[model samples]
Structures are given as structure tokens and as C-alpha cells.
Target: MRLFPQSLRWRLSAVIAVVSVLVAVALSLLVRTEFSRMQLADARRVQDERIQLVVRDYGLSGDATLGAELDSTSIPAELRAAVKGGKRATYLERDATGAWIWAAAETNGKVLSLKTSYADRDRALDRLDEVLTIGSAGVLVLGSLLGIVLGSRLSRRLRKAASAARKVAEGDQETRVGATIGTRPRDETTELAQAVDAMAAALRARLIAEQRVTADIAHELRTPVTGLVTAAELLPPSRPAELVRDRVGVLRRLVEDILEVARLDTAAERADPVELELGEFVRRVASMNPDAEVRVTGEQQARTDPRRLERVLTNLLINAERHGAPPVEVEVDGLTVRVRDHGPGFPDELLREGPSRFRTASSDRGGGHGLGLTIASAQARVLDADLRLANAPDGGALVTLELPDRP
Candidate 1:
């Protein structure tokens, strides 16, 4: 038979109960056996004492007439026969000359025979065995019942936890297994519940973030798409050159935005890193946009992918020109670069979102996708830099790019 139970709660309870029962049964059997042995010994001692008394009384009377005084009712017939039998007890009659003699003694004209007390002892032992058997049965029943009750309670608690976990798995973020104040769960179960709750919370947050990113992407893509459609419809060979240039510039900027987004996604795996000077680099990028006042503030150098870094700075300056009032300031510290635009700063809601693909704070702006800042932030990550967006207390948005001082 299998010794261990299958279920955890039953297994534990069975082990405890079985061990308890075995100890109790063993002790009971030992006590019962000892009692039975003592009883048998007492019976034998009484038999011996009576035999000696009867013999002494018969000898003093000079006759076998002491039989009438012997209480035969006190001893069973089997015991009397065994004590009187030649193999066990010797009976003798002596003449005046002390010569040995034998005489047949009868009780009421019946011959006495040797008796054995083994049968009585056997009966006593059988009674003891019966009592022990009944006690063991009771103990076993009681132990099993206790095991069942304890196991049932534990199983119920586990089932409740499992049910709550299932609800969480099925997308119920609020599902929780309430801590049992009456009987606290063990460490393993408590840890499992905690881990499940954490996972549910994380999953919910990720889903929400993804949904926001999707919405922002759609909003950003709409402006460029509408402009492209309008420009295509109004294409005219007779249009003024300035008008044509303006329309073409709009189309080129839109394409650049699209390409920059794609590059940010692939840069980490595709781009190669190179060494460059921060001071000269910022000056060169700023020169590209003369309309903006870009200044290098610190003398730190870095080893980075030049092409990607240039793209990042260029996009930032472009974003400033499109959204800010005037004189966009670019300052470089040891490993940090700060770009401040003199414009109405970032929207309060957009600051919490950090940055994501195609997300911009210019939904209210005339007609432009909010992709420039998003693209810049993604490129910063590919270069292993941190980009933070905050509003200047005075009045403007400050974009900080903190890079590592690389060799």
C-alpha cells in the first residue's frame, strides 16, 4: 500500500495522524501485554500457595482427610489436575516406618486428575486482545476524522486562491486574494498571491501605455497626410515658384519625419558608434539652422555614432523653430545638453507620458504631426542617452539630453 497521501494537505495530515496512531497503538499493545502477563503470574502464584497449604494440612492430620477442608471451588478442575499430575506435582503417603505409599484420593467417589491453568490464562489474554483491538479501532477512526477536517480546511483556502488567480489571468486587474486573518497562508502561498497581483498590475499598465501610443501615432500621422493630399490636388505648372517651393518643403519635412521614426526603431542594431567632440559637434549642428541660437556650454567629449547624434540635435532644433517663439537656446554641459525654446512650454498632460513614437504636444498647433520630439527621444535611447522633458519655470519647454562622457 502507498504510505503517503497524494494531495499536499492530505499528505501532511496523514503523516501526522499515522505517526500518532502508530505510537498510541504500540503503547497500548505494550501496556495490555504487560497487564495480561502480570495477571497470569498472579494466578500461578495463588495456585502454588494453595497447593502448599493443602499439603501441610493433610500431613498434620496423618490422613488424606484434609480434602474436605480444601476449597475446590476456588480452583478450576483443569488447574487441580495439572497440579496433581505426576509430571507436575508429587503426591505421597508415608507409613509409620516412613516408607513411601500411594493412595487414590477421590472427591465424592470421583478420581482427581491433573489440571492445567493454561486455558484460563489463554482466556485472560484473549480478553486483553479484544480490548486492545477495540481501542485501536477507535483511535484509527478518530485520527482519520481529524485528518479529513484539517485537510478540508486547507484545501478550501487553496481553492479560493486558485479561483482568484484565474480571475486575474482572465484580465481582472482588480482581483485579489484577501489575506486570511483567521488563518494566515503559508509563505509559499502568500508569495504566489503577491507575485500574481504584481503581474496583473504590470500587464494593465502596459496595455494602457500601448493604447495611448496607438492614439498618439494616429493623431500625429493625420496632419502630414492631409497636407500631402492637399498639395497633390493643387499641383499646377503655372503656380508661383515660391508657392511651389513652400509646398515641396512641406512634403520633404513630412518624409523626413517618417524616415526618422523608422531609423529610431532600427538604430540600435544597425548604427555604428564613433568618437566625436561635443563642442565642435553642437556648433556644426547649430550652424545648419542659422535661425536658431545654438550654443555649446561645456567642454566634454564623447564616443557616439555621429550620424545618429546629428539627426537627434537637428530634430530638436527643428521642433523648437516650429513651436517656439524665438532664439532657441542649446547648451551643453559635461555630459548633458539642454535645448530651451522661448515658447509656451509642453502641455502639462504630455510631460507625464515621457516620450513615444509619433507623440507630440502640438495637437492644437495649426497642421503638423507631433513626431519631431518623439523621434529625438527614441534616437537618444539608441545612443544610450537619457532625454528628459520639462517646462522652464519662466516660460518655455526645456529638453535635456544627458549623455555619458565617453572615450
Candidate 2:
């Protein structure tokens, strides 16, 4: 289905080969033209000299002999016409016999003509053509080979830069393309690599500044939020007092979520792996939440950080419960767990751009601070698990968590 190669290296090589072939053909034509002109000129010179010698011999002996023809009709028409006009002319002509270099001249009342075989010149041109064909082919092959080498080198450098960009996109801010450094001239590939590294450095600095600000704000608010919660606790056991306490509690939880997100963003928390039965773990975690429906399909065990895993699952459950309709289902199969809620599925933006902090799923679903899935994703990273968020085919938000098999 493809007419040409999809690789940069092959395209480059093809371009080079085409150009080389054109150049080779142009040069070959020029060389053949010049050589033919020179050979023809030489043949004319030899023919003129021989004609003069024949004329002299005829004048001295008064006899037409010795490779000379008297008014020969074998002479070319153009050359014969020139001789008839009382002038000498030389012409190259080819016939069944072979190529000939003809010279004719008028003397007194008679026309003298002489011709020599041009097979030598023809043979020389043939050899030259052969050489040119071989040389042009060699040029084409050499150009393609050189193009492939250069293209491969450039392709490799670009791939390195692309790989580094992928890593940076995947939340590895430290990943960089390590471009070549030397006195040699920097090419486009090197420039691209350098640009990737620069972009990553800038991004890392920006993210660090954002995380530091978030962490600082959370740290500053923790004390005031704690004091507010304590004051609300002392107020009284009335509706207004309970409302105050509830608001303070929400504030406290928000602050804690912010702090946790900050820590996860900076990768300050490391996983502590512990061998545990995955099915039992899912049942226990789901049991804590009365609304969730747990179904352990198979008994599977894994070596993973149970604490981090619990955090991720808890966020998913809570997010589903709060933002989705009732009948939240949790299924454990092998090393994977699936959590689904019967409600309008995740928002298009959330599914497209992954989870973002402070960006609620939707107004339709009871919205919160919107850090649940973000925290869950970060915790999944720490646990070295794969967390996928999707809208179930039937309906509702579906989240699949697959733990790494390191048993």
C-alpha cells in the first residue's frame, strides 16, 4: 500500500541517489559531447592533410592512383556539392560499411575525393560510454550508501531526544537528552536535543516552584485550621455548632489533601512493599466502606506497598461514591482491581487530559476539591502500579488498578 519508505533515513537516501543520478547523467552527456567534438575536429584535420597529399601526387604523375578516387560518387552529397563549387570540404558520414571521414577538392576541371574509416573513433566513443555508465552507477550507489549513513546518525539522535521528551512527559522532570558536546559544528539534531534538555529543565523548575508554594500554603493553614476545629468542638452540641464543626472538618481535610498532593508531586514518599493477598486486601478495604459492593473473583497475591495501594483505592471509592450514582462495584481479579460506579461517567476533559488537581469532574456529580484521582494517580506511581480511568461501556466511571507482578 505504501509507495515509498516511511523512514527518514530511506527518504534521505533516496533524495541523494536521485540527485547523484542526475548529476552523473549531466556530466556524462557533457563529457561525451566535448569528446565527440574534439574527435570530429581531429578527423577533419587528418582528412585535409591526406587530400592535399593525394592532389600533389596526381599533379606530379598526372595519374589518379594510391587510395585516391577521381570524382567519386561515394563521397557525401554535401562534400560533393562543396567540391563542385570549386572548394574543398570534409565531412563525417556513416553507412552500412561503417563510419567514414570524407574529404573532397576541385582541381582544374576534375574533382578529387578521399575517405578513411571512422571505426576507431566509433569504438573509442563506445568505450567511453561504457565507462560513463559504470561511473554513473557507482555514483548512485555511493550516494545512497552515504545518505543512509548520515540519515541513520541523524535518526538515532532524534530518537534519543524523543525518548527523553517522553520521559519528561511521563513526570520524570530530571530526564534530559544529553546532547553532544565538542568543537565540531552543531547540527539540527544536536540543536533539537539541546532544546529538549532546556525545556525539561524549565519545566522541572516551574513544577518545583508550584509544589513548594502549595506545600507552604498547606503548612501555614494547618495550625489555623486545627485551632478552628478545636474552637468549633467547644462551641456546643447544637445544629449551628455541628455545622461549624463540619465546615472546619472539611477545611482540615482540604488542607491535608493539599499537603499530601504536595508530597506526592515532589516524590517525597517512597513505597514500602509488603507481601499480601490482593483479593483479601480488596475485601477488607471495601468492607470499611459500607456502600461499596465487593466481589473477589480469584485469590491473587502480590508484593506491593499495601498502604499506598489502600490510599489509591480509597480515593477511587470515595470519588466514585461522591461523584457517581449508587451501587458502587469493586472487583478483584488476579493482580488487578476494578471499581465502577453507576452514574454519568467521567467528564470528557478529565478522560482526555487525565486527572488534574482542583478541577472537579462535573457539577452534575457532587463536586469536591478534585484532588482524589490526582492523589490516587500519584500514589499509584509510588506503588509502581498502572491506574486507568475510563467511562464504562454501559454507564458510570470505571477505574482499573493493576499492581506490578513481583511475587
Candidate 3:
């Protein structure tokens, strides 16, 4: 469907090839023109020399039979007219005998004409043309090859830099493009690599500072939250007391979620791999939520950290149940667990950017801190699983978790 290649390497090669072809064609035309002119001039010179010889012989010996055609019609009408007017002239003509150059001039009231074969010059010109054509083709091919090599090298460097940038965006702070580029010369690609490295370093530092602040705040709130919980429990039973206790519980959970995120950010969670009957494990997790409908397509096994997977699935179920419309479904097929909710699907921003902590769904969709899916995704990563979030065709949020079946 594409008229031109999308790849930069091919685009560069094409550009160079087209330019080379144009240059070759232009040079060929110029060379051909010059060569033709030179050959014509040489032929005319030979014709003139023969004409001079015949005319001199006729003038000295009074005989025009020195291999000269007197008033010959072999000479063109224009050439004959010119000689009759006492003017010397030379002309080229081609016939069955190949090519000829004729020279004529007035000699004692007789037109003395001489002719010579121009086939040798024509053949030489043909050879020159053949050589030019071959050379032009060679230039085109060589230019294309050189363009491919240069473009490939440049594209490879750009890919490395882009990959490093992607890793950085995915929270791999240690990834650096400069390391991949090695000791290359400082060109545009090298500058881009350097820029990416600097950006990663800055982001890494800022993320560390943010994580430390979050962890410290959570740690500081833990003791006070515990005290609040105890105080709420001791209060006399009433509506206000219940509300206080509920809010205190919410606070405690928020602190826990923040701590968990901090730990995940630090990459401190290690998976304890265990072989699990994936269907049964999913059934058990889904059973905790009576509203969820669990279906197992077939028996399957996975080597993963069950605890982390449990956390991920629980979060997904809670998110769906709270935000989505009724009929939250959990389907286990192979090593994949799919959770779907007939809600307004995920918010457009959420689908575009994934989950961000504390960024809750829009008021129209549902209400909660957005940490559920974020924590779920982080835990899924710890289990080395693929967690994808998408909107179901019929309308709802669909979250798929695919676990590794092998160690």
C-alpha cells in the first residue's frame, strides 16, 4: 500500500541512487555530444586534406583525374552550389556503404569533389557510447551500495539510542545509549545518544528522590495510623464512629499501597517461582469475589510466584468490580487469565498512558485511588508475566495476564 519505503535506510539509499542516476545520465549526454563533435571535426579535416590534394594536382598538371569527381552529383545539391560559388564545403552522409564525408571546392571552373569513409569515426563513437553507458550503470550501482552501507550504520546507531530511551522510560535507570554506541565519532547520532543518556540520568535521579520521599512519608504515617485505628475501635458504637473507623482503614490501605509501590520501584521484590495448577489457582482467587464468574477453558500449569500473581489478580478483580458494570468475568485459558467488566471500558487517558498511582478513574466511571492497576502491573512484572489492558469490543475493560509456563 505504501508508495515509498518507510525505512530510513531505504529512503537514504533511494535518494543517493536517484542522484547518481541523474548525474550519470547528464555526464553521458555531455560526453556523447562532445565526442560526436570531435569525430565530425576530425572527419571534416580528413575530407579537406583530400580535397586540397586533388585541387593542387589539377592546378599543376592541368588534369583533374587525380581520383577526384568532377561536377559529380555524389556531392549534395547544397555542397555543389557552394563550390560553384567558389566556396569550399564538407558534409557527412550515411548510405548502404556505411558513412561518408564529402569535401568539394571550385578548381579552374570545375567542381573538384573528394569523399572518405566516416564509418571508422562512427564506430569509434559507438564504442565511446557503450563505455559511457557501462560507466553510468557502474556509478548507479556503486552509489546505491555505498548509500545502503552508510544508511544502515546510521539507522543502527539510531535504533540503539531509541532502545536505550525506551528502557529508561520503562524504569530501567541503568540503561545508557552511550554504552551501546561505544567510542564512535561525535556526529548527530552520537549527540542523540549522549542526550538520551543524560535524560536517563536526570530521570533516574529524580525518580530516586521521589521514591525516597514517598517511602519516608509512608513510614512516618504507619505508627499514627495504627494509633488512629485503635482509637476508632475503642470509640462507642455509632454512625460517626463507623465512618471514622472506615476512613482510618482507608488511610492504612493507602499507606500500604504507597509502600508497596516504593518497594516495586526499588526492584526489591523477588519472585519465588513455584509450579501452579493455573486453573485451580485462578478459581481460588476468583472465588473470593462472589460476584465474579470464573471459567476454566482447559487445564494448564505455570511456573510463577503464586503470591504475586494472587495480588495482581485480586487487584484486577477489585478494580473491575468497583469501576465496571455487572457481570465481571474471569476466564483462564492456557496460562492466561483474562478479566472483563461490562463497564464504560477504561478511560481514554488510562488506555493511552496505562495506570498511574493515585490517578483515579473519572467520576462518571467510578471512584478509587488509581493504585490498583499500577500495583497489579508492578506485581505482574515481578512474576515476569505479560499484563495487557485493553477495551473489549462489546464495551468494557479487559485485562489479560499471561504467565510463563516454563522456568
**lDDT tens digits by residue: candidate 3, 1-407:** 99999989999999999999999999999999998998899889877887888888888887765477887867878778777767788988788878988899896677988877788888898999899999999999999999999889888888888887788788776678888876576798887788878877887888899999999999999999999999999999999999999999999999999999999989878999988899999999998888899999977878899888899999999999899987999999998899999999998899899899989897767788899999999999888899999999999999999887664
Candidate with better lDDT, 1 vs 2: 2
TM-score for candidate 3, please give it.
Answer: 0.90
Q: Each prediction's TM-score against the native?
A: 0.43, 0.95, 0.90
**Candidate 1 Cα outliers beyond 4 Å, as residue runs:** 1-245, 266-268, 356-367
lDDT of 1 at 364: 38
Kindly state the number of residue pairs that clash in model 3: 0
State each model's CA lDDT, in order: 0.65, 0.87, 0.89
Clash pairs (backbone) in predicted model 2:
none
Cα error of candidate 1 at position 36, Å: 34
- A best-first ranking of the candidates according to their lDDT comes to 3, 2, 1
Kindly give the stretch of ten consecutive residues in candidate 3 with the minimal lDDT sum: 62-71
Q: Which stretches of candidate 2 lie over 4 Å from their true place?
A: 179-185
Stretches of candidate 3 exceeding 4 Å from the true structure: none
Q: Kindly list the per-residue Cα lDDT of model 1 for residues 345-371, writing each as its tens digit.
A: 787776886655545565532234677
lDDT of 1 at 28: 84
| True-structure RMSD, every candidate | 16.7, 1.8, 2.5
- Pairs of residues clashing in candidate 1: 78-115, 78-116, 81-113, 81-114, 81-115, 82-114, 82-115
